[model samples]
Target chain A: MEKGKIIELYRKMLEIRLFEEKVFELYGQNIVPGTIHLYIGEEAIAAGVCSNLRKDDYIVSTHRGHGHCIAKGARLDMTMAEILGKKTGYCRGKGGSMHIADFSVGMLGATAVVGAGIPIATGAGLSIKLRGTDQVVACFFGDGAANQGTFHEGINLAAVWKLPVVFICENNLYAMGTCQSQVMLIKDIAERATAYGIPGVSVNGNDAIAVYETAEKAIKHARHGNGPSLIECKTYRHKGHSRFDPATYRPKEEVEEWLKKDPIQNLKRQLLEKGYLLNAGMAQIEREVNDIIEKAAQFAIDSPYPPPEEALENVYA
Target chain B: MSMHNGDGKMRVITYRDAIREALLEEMKRDNTVFLLGEDIGRCWEGAFKVTKGLAEEFGDERVRDTPISESAIIGTAVGAAITGMKPIAEIMFGDLTTLAMDQIANQAAKIHYMFGAQAKVPLVIRTPFGGGVNIAAHHSQSLEAWFMHIPGLLVAVPSTAYDAKGLLKTAIQGSNPIIFCEHKLLYPTEGPVPEEDYTIPLGIADIKNEGEDLTIVATMFMVHKALNAARMLKKEGLGIEVVDPRTLVPLDKKTIIDSVKKTGRLVIAAEDCKTAGVTAEIAAMVAEEAIDYLDAPIRRVAEPDTPIPFSPPLEKYVIPDERRIIKTIREII
Candidate 1:
């Protein structure tokens, strides 16, 4: 990757990390309505995988989808407004955090149903092939989703048609407080791809460069008319699954161990080691990102709520 | 083309042929239109043969065959539809719709509103419903009411070949998602259809048999049975009007209420279970808006609240037939 690209990736990762931290702060103050599923630790996967996509290419997101939307180039103001339930947000605040979508930026809405978006992404790939377009789709899901029936049916169909799609599995080691090992026997979720007759690879989710390179290869393969590829990023969730989740289910040592491997910190270290970024530059980027986030939050709070009459609209068209 | 045949040549076709013709005509007209379902290709030719020979004509891509995965089939069709493809997804049996209800009701129907209308899911999900031929509980069902209750869904239940062809065409070209209800028993029944291309606008009811004593409202196969009851009543010096609401969601309340106003009596008949079905809604609509016009209590003729059984006699007993419709109508008039 070029120097400018790595810096860009680091910035995107920083944006997700900061955005999530702000969400936690707001949630702590009880300012935001509804619970949020944080993507604090899996920031690299979103930043790296989305780096290879074009504005017109599509991606189906999961409940933990704010990072994916931001990485896909959705405006921060609209995303913040959406999570704040303001009319200025994406979907005009009809969809809260989990359902944010900006069609213009290739974000095809987030689905709360686990693994439900997989077939949707595959169908998008089918649409591209049927329309004779070279556009590809990136489907993002968690490790637990791999156990769902849609995961098998969707990936198998995509493999059958050799559709232009890359299935990115963020193996965060847990599915809503349940460990992956307890849920399924398989250790590597990517291995499941072998059954579908497609290429499968596992990567370090904390390492932004490795993730970026692996995602690039898989995206290229799909774009070249090669069948879909399943990429499992070995990652962890830095916090509890959702708000009010005390995480008493997990051991303290495990949480601390994963915390040491924070993706944002890892990316910053790599950038500094490569001499691409210095402390002063890192501090400067943080300041800029913080300012942007502050403005976005203000925009969200200032935006008006949709009138009750508007709720009756959009059900037909 | 014009609605009427310029040469006065009428086409006599079955309900199955009309559905196929609609699919063929719409697919040929719009490149984005495609069909997805189980056993719908050249090999199996669909469970009912409604899609027979479609793959050969349009190629496998357009007339695609799918596995028995109901949720994936429906969800994938939803995805394709929102992405600019006009997909017509079919569930082999209407009873099997329960298997894919999440996708049909939640994903496809709510996406338009949930996404703030940024996208529209132009999907037509066609399923064969109604009890007949001793198919048992799993195969035979009249579940149109289940879809009608959901918002953002257009429900079309056509009783004749002309209505089926025209409504299916309108559904494919329509911007909203539609639940196209095709009756299992009506597939082989023949009706007069125009040779030229045309579409029947949704939310319009067609009066099958005009009468004066009472207005009889029905849907799907019950429409024909109600007409049969009206014919028999005519021999007894009683006149009844039979109205078939082509689409249930955008139901033409005006036509039904006007007919009831003229007749001063109304009888709503449907093949679905009696409790909380389409009849209940129409009855309430009439009672709310046209109560002053009614001279007697409204009547509803529907299947008893029970699952269809395997025994032929038992199955026939549960379905709302001409006798049941006539009994209800006679009591009302």
Candidate 2:
């Protein structure tokens, strides 16, 4: 990739990492309400896949969806406001972290129900096909969702119909606390795509360039009306399933090993080696990201809560 | 497409055909409208033949046959609806809706509100719910009350061909998720339907029969049972009013309450189980709103808390009938 494009991807990854860190800080201060599933380590997959999509293309996200929304161009202040349960936030504070969405950029809302958004993303692709539009939908789910009946049903329908949908599975190796080996006998989640007669590939999710290149090919295949494909990005979460539970289930060595290969750090090291970014450029980007996160947190704290009567509104239409 | 007779005459058709006509007219009127379900295409033409000949008319693209995944069927419809396509999905039987409850209740019913009015789900779920058929527990059920309890869903229960065609057309035109419930027994039953296109609003109630001595609030197949009981009561110098609240969620509370006030008596008849059922909701509404107008305590006619048995006699015993309506009415009067 060119220097400018690589820097763009690096900046996006940084935004997600810094934004989530700020969310963790706010949570510690008891300002961000409700539970949160931080996307701290798996930033490459969202940044990589969403970088290739247009503003008109649709994406259905999961519980850990803040990274996806940010990559899809959601404003950091609104996302922070939503997490803080403010009236000015996306969804008017009705939807907190788990349900945040910005339809203006085709972020088709995040569903907390495991694997439920799979078929909905397929439906969005079906709508695109029926309308004779070239738009595509990126369906994001976890390795655990691959076991859900919706995974089978949703992918089968999209495959049979040749709908423009790319199923991206972020295999963090563990669903909450149970490891992947305990649930499935298979090694790679992407291999399950053969059952639906679609191409499937597994790539290093910690490497931004690898994920972006793989997603580019899969998205092209979908845009050309060939069919849907599954791209399994092998990665891990940096925190527990939610903020409350401690992830002691993971081995100390395993956590330490994965933390060294963190997506943002990996991308930064690659950028420096390829002469895409200088030391001063890297420092400049980090300072800019930190400034943005601080402002978003302040805006969220300063925003007002929605009036009690506003709850009764928007129930219909 | 010209089912209308230009000459002044009432065009009659079966309840199943009325629903089919509504779908056909709406699909033709709006290119965005389409249909999808298990075995609803050309080969099967729907399990109840409600979509007979539609696949041939609209082609496989518009009238699509889907896999036996109920969740995908409704979930995809929700996706399509939010994306500007009006998809009418069929779940074959209402009992099977439990498999897709998350999509229906959590996703479709809550999306627009949860998303801060960013989108509207103009989707319709058409299914048959009743106990007249000997399909047993897995197939026979009256689950309209379940959808009624959902905040964002509009539950439409059409007892006759007129209401079926009219309410279904309205459901197609409106921008909301609707659970259109058709009764199994009423499918083949014939009734007078107008040739011209018409639509009945979702919240309106229709008085099938007017009387003065007592009022009977009924829905779906129970409306017919209540009317039959009303006729029997009329022969014995008693007058009974039969009111069918066609749509349950936006219930015609005003009409029902006014009927109760005029007759000074109320009896709610529904095919669902007696506890926490449609009858209970209406009975409670009347009790809260028109208690002072009642000359006697309210009575309820509903199925007992048991699944519909396969045996013919047992099935007949479990389903509410005209005899049960009459007994309940007599008690209230």
Candidate 3:
């Protein structure tokens, strides 16, 4: 990666980490309504995969989708406004955090249902292939979604047709507290890809550069019509599943061990060591990102709720 | 290509031909419109011959065929619709809708609302309903009431050739998920349909025969039966109004209620089983809203709450026929 590009990636990872932290804080204070699935430690997976994508290349995200939306170039104000249920949000306050979408930037809406977007992304890939466009779709899912019928059916169909899709599984080791070992006998989620006759790659999701490189190769293969690829990003979440969880199901030692490999810290260290970012530059970037986030929060706060009559406006068309 | 007249007017055509014409005209007009179902294009000509020559004209890609997997068929259509493809998936039989209820109810029906109206699932599920053809219980069930209960879906059941063409055109152009129910018995039945492109809006009910004594609201095959019953009632100087609620979900309750207010009585004739069916819901709505104008209790003429029997006589006994509808209307009046 270029020196400037490395710094930009680090800045994005930091922005996501801080944005999520702020959201967590606000959520605790009852400012953000409804439950939130935070994308704290999984920031590198989104940053790495989305770095190689263009504005027209599509991505379908999961419930933990703030990082994907930010990384894919959705405006911070729109995302925050959506989460806050403001009319200025990307979906005009109709979709909450789990359903935020900016199709103009190729973020084709995040889904609250696990594995439901897999077939949708594959269908988008099918449309691209049939139209003879080189556009590719990146479908994101959790470790738990791998067990869904949609995962098997969607991946198998995409593989058979050689549709332009990258199935990225962020195997965070827990499906809302159940560990992978307790759920499945297999150690690697990537091993399931072979059943669908697709190439699967496992990577250290904390390493943004490594994730980006792997995504680049998979995206290139997909765009070339070589077929879909399965990428399992081995990562961890810093927070519990939702607002209510105490995370008692997880061991303290494992949590501390994973915390040591935080993607934001790793990226910042790499950038600083490579002479891409100085302390002053990093501080300035933080100030700028913080200002943007503050403005977003204010925008969300100032926006009005949807009118009572507007509830039935978009039910049909 | 040529126009012919019978009885010194335009010639009549079957409801099946009207549907085929609608598909052809819509495909020619919009490039996004496509067809998919089991034997829709090639082998058996759509099981009811509704898509007989479409594959030859539009090619297999546009008029595609699929394996007999109702779930996958509906699932794929839902996926395609969300990704900017307007697909019309045929369920082969209305009873098969049970196999794909998850995709229909949980996914397609809720995609727009769940996604906060950011996405539109502009797909139509076309299937033949009702038990008059004696195709047995599985093939002959009426499931429109099932789909009508869903909030985000539009249910259309056309009884005439004109409606078969116009309502389908409306369904294809509309941005909502539509359940277009066609009665198997009406496919060969003939009527006059306009040659021009047209659409019947989703929530409007059509009054077939206007009268002042009792209002009859029916759907699919029952509309024809109700009309026949109206003719029989007219011989005895009984004035019976027949209203066809083309779309069930966004039901034209105003039309039915207004007619009931004028007539002071109501009889909902449906081919589906009576218990908790679409007729029961409409009866309850009318009783709630138009109670002041009612002189008699709202009567529902429908099949018994049981699977359609394979025997012809038993099937006739179960499904509401014109004699039963006429008797019910007379009793209500």
Candidate 4:
């Protein structure tokens, strides 16, 4: 990546980290109504992966999808207002957190049902192919979703049809408290790609450079009609599955160790070490990000709730 | 051998042929329309051959064949529909709908509502259901009630070739997702349907046979049975009117209530199970809307609450036949 591109990637990771932290704060203050799955530690994967997609290219997200939505160009205020159940939200308070979407930017909504987004992305890729467009689709799911049937079915179909899709599995070590070792036999979920006759690779999801390089190559291959690929981002969720439990089931050493390798801090240090960002510039970026989040929070708090009667207004065409 | 079959300006055709013709006509008219499902191609010809010679005309992309992943098939269709295309997805048998309930009920039906009406899911899920084929419970089922319960979906249960052809065309062109129910046993049944380009706006009830004593409201294959029972009851000096509500969701309450007020008796007949079924829902509608006009309590003739059996005698015992319809109508009258 060029210096400017590398700096932009670092900025994106910082934005996502700050955004998620604000969500955690707002959620703690009881501003958010429904439950949320925070994309706390896995910021680099979303930023790196979405950075490679065009505005018209599609993406399907999972429950823990705030980072993905923001990285894919969704307005921060609308997403925050959505989590607060305000009518100004992207879904008009109907979808809340997990279902927030902006079709304008080709974010095909989120599916809370684990692997359900896989088939939807593959289908969107199929639609692109049918319409004879060069648009690609990036499907984001967790490691646990790799075990779901939709994962296998979706990958197999995309392989056969050579649909322009990239399946990005953010293997956060634990799937909502259950460690990967407890649920999967294969240590590398990327190896499952062989079954579908596609290329599979595991990358350091915390390293934005590694993920961006890998994703750029995969996306290029797909956009050129080479077929779909599996990219497993080996990362960790810094927080619990939702805003509930403290993730006490995980060992203390493991949690502490993953926290030390936090992607946001790592990217900041790298940018400084590489002379791409100065100490003053880093401070400025942090302050700017804080200002943006504060504005988004204020907007979310001031937004009004939808009228109770509008709930049934959009149930049909 | 007469083309018109003595009907006004329409040719006689089987229900299967009418459905096929509808697909052909719509696909020809709109380039965005396509068909995709398991066993729907040049070789399989759609398991029931409803798509015979379509793949040759439309090619593999238009009449696409899928693997045995009903979830993927439907998910793909929903994704495709919301994006731009009008996909007529087939689920072979209605019983297999259990395999795809999430994509159909949760995803396709709720996208328009859940997204604050940002998108229109113009998708049609066509499936052949009903127990008369003796294909047993897994392959045969009358589960229109399952889809009718979903808020965003439009449920269409066409009983004749005319309604089937006209309604399928309208469903393909409409803006909402539709569960197009076609009965397996009714596919070969023939009726008069016009060949001219026309469409039946949904929510209109088609009165198959008119009478004065009672309104025998029926659906799918049960409409034919009600008509047969109407014929048998006419010999006994009993006038039984048969009403087929072509589309169940946007039900024609005006026609049904009018018929009930005129006859003062109603019997809701369906192939679904008796309790909490389509029959029960219709009976509740008639009771709620036109109770004062009723001469007697609304009766429902429906399948017993059990899985359709494989043995001929056992299956015959559960499914409502002409004898059951006639007997139930006589009691209600």
Candidate 5:
């Protein structure tokens, strides 16, 4: 990868990390309402996959979608405002964290229903095919969604129709609290792709470079009209499913073991080893990211809530 | 076949053909329009042949056939609609819409509002409802009330060829998600339709026959049944007015209320179940909005609260017909 592109990826990962940490802090202060599924550990997959996509290209996200949104060019201020339920949000306070979308950037929005966005992303690919556009869709979902019926039905449709979609499974080992061992007999989630006659691959989700390379191949394949492919990024979430979750169900040693391979630190170390980023350079980037996230939170706090009557608007048309 | 009448040349076509014509015309008029569903393409055409010969005309890409995945079918349409393409997905049977309820009720219907008006779902879900052919509980159902209860979905239940063609054209052109419910029995029924392009905007009710004694509001096949019952009552010196609220979601409450105020009596006949069905909504609307205009107890002619049976006798017993509607009207009047 070029130095400029690698630096860009590192900056995006830091942005996500800092933004999520700020959201966690805001949640504790009661400034953020409802619950949030943060993208603490699984940053590489989003950065890697979305970096390969153009602004016109589409990406469908899951409930844990802030990372995807950030990587797909969503402004921190707008995203923060949306999470704050302010009128200045991307969805004008209508869609909060789980449903935030910026159509201008082709972040086709996120669906709270697990596995539901898979078919929808496939449909966007179908639209690309029908309109004869070179655009491709990157559909992100959790390991748990692979077990949902839509995973099968949606992927099958895309494979058969040869729609331009790359199915990226962020296999975080557990779905809510259920471990992958308790769910499916198969070891690798990518193996499921063979059922639909598509190329399937698994990569280290923590390694941003590896994920970027894997995604590059899959996205290229889709853009060339070779049909959909499944790329499972084996990663782990640093936090619990939601803010309220203690995650006591997870083994202490297992959690610590995965925490060592945190995606942000992994990429940072790689940058350091390559002499691409010095300690001072990294410190400056951290300060810059912190400043951006703080401004976003402050902007959200200062922003006014949408009028109650605004709820009645946009019910139709 | 065409007829020359007072309103220019009118082409008589089957309800099925009318729907097909609307689809064909829309596809020709807009390059963004395409279709996807189970067995809706060439060979199988459609279960009821509503999309027969469409694939050969538009090519396989536009008239795509899909697997028996109702959720994905509707989901794909929702995705395509929000992005650019206008997809018309057929659910084959209205009963099967339950399988895709999440996609319909949760995703497609709510995407526009939930996304803060960022996108619009200009899509159509066409399915056959009602129970005249005795296809049993799985295939035959009048599930329009389910969709009408949803906030964002537009429900169209057209009875005649003219309405089907016009309403369908309007549905295709509109920028909202629509559940276009077709009746199995009405597919073969022929009605006069104009050859030229026309569209019947949703939420508008049409008065099938004008009268003064009573107002009979119906939907889908029940509209034809109400018309027949009105004709019979007209001969008996009881003038019965028949009203068809073509779209249930954007209901023509003013038209129905005006008719009720004029006639001073209201009878609702629908093919769905009696409890909380389309009739219940219309009756409640009238009772709430125009109760003082009512001279007698409001009556509803709807199917009994049971799954449509395969046996002809049981099916006939449950489904509301012209006789049941006429009986209901007589009791109300």
Candidate 6:
């Protein structure tokens, strides 16, 4: 990859890390209501996969979806407003963090239900194939969702039809607080993809370049009408399942070991060593990002709440 | 097959023929409209023969059949609807809706709303409900009340042949998800339906028999029973008014209330289980809103809570017959 492209990817990863840190702080101060599922350690997976996608390519996200939205080019201020329950948000404050969607950018929508979006993305791909378009759909789900019935049905159907969809699984190793080992006997989730007669690969999720390269190949194969592929990214989350979880279920050594491979820090070090970003340049980028987030926070705080009567407005049609 | 104008009104047709005509007309009107279900296009002509000749007219792609997996059938139709196709999925039996409740209630009913109205799920789920055919409990059940509890869905129940065609046409053209409940016994029943194209708006109630002594609000097959009860009570010098609220979700409460005010008594009849059924709901609505206008306590003539039995005697004992409906109205008055 080019040095300039690598720096750009690093910058995107930094924006996501700092944005999530700010959201965590505001959530602590009671500025945002409702529960939130953070995407702190999963930044590389989103940034890497989305870097290879075109404007018309589609993506369906999970409940921990902010990183995917930002990486897919959704405006940070609008997404923040949505999280704060403001009318100016992507869904007019009706859909909070878990349900953010911008169809104009081909981000179909995020579903809070586990594995529900898989068949939806497959159906979208079916639409593309029927229209004779080369467009592909990238469906993102957690390791927990792999056990859902929709996962089996959706993947099998896509494989049989040769639909243009890339099933990206971010294997954070836990479904809520339960570890992956407790649920499945197999060590690698991608290995199950072979049962559906599809190519499956497990990649180092902490390495942005590896994830980007894997996703690029899978997406290219899908667009060329070869078939669907299952690409599992091995990663970890810095926070618990949600805002209320303290993550007591996980061991201390595991957390410590995974923290050492933080994708943002790894990319930052590579960019600095390669002469793509000097100390001054890094400081300027940090300042600009901070100012943008500050404006987003103010916009969310100032936006109005939806009218009470509007509750019954969108029930039908 | 000659068209006739009696009393300067459109000619009469069978309810089954009306439904088939609606499907034919809608398919011609919209290229995206398609049909899918089990034996829907078979030469045997559907279970009730509503989709009799559609397969030959539109070809196999437009009129398709499927394996008996209700979940897969409904789920695939949902998938088709969201991706720009207007699919009319048929659930062969109303009792079978239980097998696909998750897809119907959780997925189809909630997708558009959960996505913040970004997409419109224009799908019609048609099923035959009610028990009078002696087809036993598993095949014959009135489950419209179960769907009425959901918020983002429209429920339409057509009683007359004209309504069977008109309401269906309206449902196909509408953008929201619709649950079109047809009565199994009413398929071969005939009534006056226009030969030309026409549509009746949903959520509107039709007053079949207007009188002064008592008001009877019913749906589907029960509407015919209430009218029959009114005829039997006429010899006894009792006046009975019959109201059929075609759609259950957006119920025509105003029309029902107006009829009750004029009659000063109300009796509701339905083929569903007596407990928490459509009849009970209508009775409760009247008790809550129009209690002051009532000269007597509201009455409900409905099937017993037990399932419909295969034996003829047992089934007759369980469901509300015309005699039971008449007795209930007499007690109320």
Docking class of 6: acceptable
lDDT of 6 by residue, B174-268 (tens): 88788899998899889987766778888889898988999999899888989998998888998899999989988999999999999999889
Candidate lDDT scores, in order, read 0.90, 0.93, 0.85, 0.89, 0.93, 0.85
Clashing pairs in 1: none
Q: What is the lDDT for A294 in model 6?
A: 86
Model 1 lDDT tens row, B93-133: 99888877877887888888888888889999999998888
**Cα lDDT over the full model 3:** 0.85
Instruction: Report lDDT (Cα) of residue B239, candidate 5.
Output: 90
Instruction: Record all residue pairs in model 2 with backbone atoms less than 3 Å apart, i.e. clashing.
Output: none
Off by over 4 Å in 6: A1-5, A129-133, A159-162, A269-284, B1-14, B36-83, B132-139, B307-312
CAPRI-style grade of the A/B interface in model 4: medium
DockQ for every prediction shown: 0.76, 0.85, 0.37, 0.74, 0.88, 0.36
- Candidates 3 and 5 compared by lDDT, better number: 5
- lDDT at position B269, candidate 2: 91
Candidate 2 lDDT by residue in tens digits, A161-265: 999999999999999999999999999999999999999999999999999999999999999999899999999999999986789999999999999999999
Error of 5 at B286 (Å): 1.0
Better of 2 and 3 by lDDT: 2
Across B219-301, the per-residue lDDT of candidate 2 in tens digits comes to 99999989999999999989999999999979999999999989999999999999999999998999999899999999999
Scored by DockQ, the top model is 5
Across B1-333, the per-residue lDDT of candidate 3 in tens digits comes to: 112223334448999999999889988998778887889987678999999989999988788776665665776677678777788889899999997787788778877876667788999999999887777888989988898788788999889897888889889988989999999999999997765556677788889999989999998889888999999889999899998887887888999999999999999988898888989989999988889989999999988899999999988889888999978876866
What would the per-residue lDDT of candidate 6 be over residues A3-90, giving only the tens digit for each residue? Answer: 8778778778877888888888889999888989999998999999998888888888989999998888888888898898888888
TM-score of 6: 0.89
The clash numbers for all candidates, in the given order, read 0, 0, 0, 0, 0, 0
Model 2 docking grade: high
- Alpha-carbon runs more than 4 Å astray in model 3: B1-9, B38-45, B67-72, B98-102, B111-117, B132-140, B305-317
Error of 2 at A84 (Å): 1.0
User: How accurate locally is residue A92 in candidate 2, as Cα lDDT from 0 to 100?
Assistant: 94
